[model samples]
Target: MLSYGVSKSSSRVPHIVTFCCNNPHHPTTTHAESHSVVTRRALSLLATATASVFSVPVLVSSSSVRYLEAAAAASTPRFSELPESGGVKALDLRVGDGDYPVNGDQVAIHYYGRLAAKQGWRFDSTYDHKDETGEPIPFIFILGSGKVIAGIETAVRSMKVGGIRRVIIPPSQGYQNMDQEPVPPNFFDRQRLFTTIFNPTRLANGEGSTLGIIIFDIELVSLKHL
Candidate 1:
């Protein structure tokens, strides 16, 4: 006869131990059999051990990780190679030969000035409350008579009447080493001060005040006979 014994610990926390003995009558028996009660006890003990070991803790995933990755990828920089004037990209022009004109020519224009970073306007003739609806005022200036900044005069000399153009004036040709009202002296040292001059004209010995970055949308209103 063959005998199998199984030992177990407590019921709430159970452990099992199995022992087997060979039968004298079955000398060549490679397998052994156990009673139903013992087999069931062994299985119960195994189930208890598995439950204790597998009931620990685990981590789960959320959308935060995916959102962060997407944000980083979107922040990548992009570059372009194109011509730029007065810090403004020129897609087209309306009037003028794209050159500066001489003095004593009647001119009309509309303009606006603001910081390069799109901050609020530093100065704008159109926004003056004195004019109803704040319309653009027309003005005239003589070229190269110390009436306007060197940059503006230079740009005007290249323009013709009834022409519109964009001018990019560096600080060197603009205020240059001087400071004026509204434009503080500190700004003169900042090399990035530029202007866009639209249409402009040369007045007849009409000396104009020197101003920085005068972008004129000039129409040759009329010219004085030489």
Candidate 2:
């Protein structure tokens, strides 16, 4: 049997959209708004603390949002691959042999999430959390139903009951506009939701930034369907 029930390789992503308001300076609204034509990010946690929230805490360091823009006319691309087109990347860390899930299936999992950077910290983990009975709290969600991030849904569908995979969720697929960058017209509602859930203190402390990429380490615990 797979504890709860069921289930990377190194990958780097270049910085995408640059923002003006995501900085430390409380710049004049007039100046900031002028530059806000295209920039933004946020996390989409659940309604309550106990709810199966998907995601990580974040970090920020550069107080130079605008400065960096000035420093490099578009920072040099970090890696050779233009990963944006991939939408989400799921690198198999461990393959499992249990039943794989199909769409509409209810799934359970244990996950550890963090920023996609080398210095990123493990912000949230089911293994680290236990109920009064000392049992780890596994997250239950319906597969391919937008219950979690798009990347997570895609990754879980490919896994068996006991597999482990490292999933990469771009700002577009993860928290939409947590970084407050330019996204699609349709995603505005999701962006607003995450903005409300994101912790300002964490951002201020350089723990995570708005609209940043998310790195998730997922283990498939079990599946109820398919």
Model 2 residue runs over 4 Å out of place are 1-86, 177-210
Q: After superposition, how far is residue 41 of candidate 1 from its true place, in Å?
A: 71
Give lDDT: candidate 2, residue 110: 85
- Candidate 1, 145-225: lDDT as tens digits: 565555445544554555544454443454544242123123432233333211124212232232233332223333332
Q: Score candidate 2 by lDDT.
A: 0.56
Number of backbone clashes in candidate 2? 31
Q: What's the TM for model 1?
A: 0.35
How many Å off is the CA of 213 in candidate 2?
0.7
Tell me the TM-score of each prediction against the true structure.
0.35, 0.48
Angstrom error of the Cα, residue 100, model 1: value is: 8.0
Q: Give me the candidate number with maximum TM-score.
A: 2
User: Per-residue alpha-carbon lDDT of model 2 for 116-154, expressed as tens digits?
Assistant: 543554456677657899888787788867646666776
Model 1 segments beyond 4 Å from truth? 1-92, 96-100, 104-106, 117-122, 126-135, 177-226
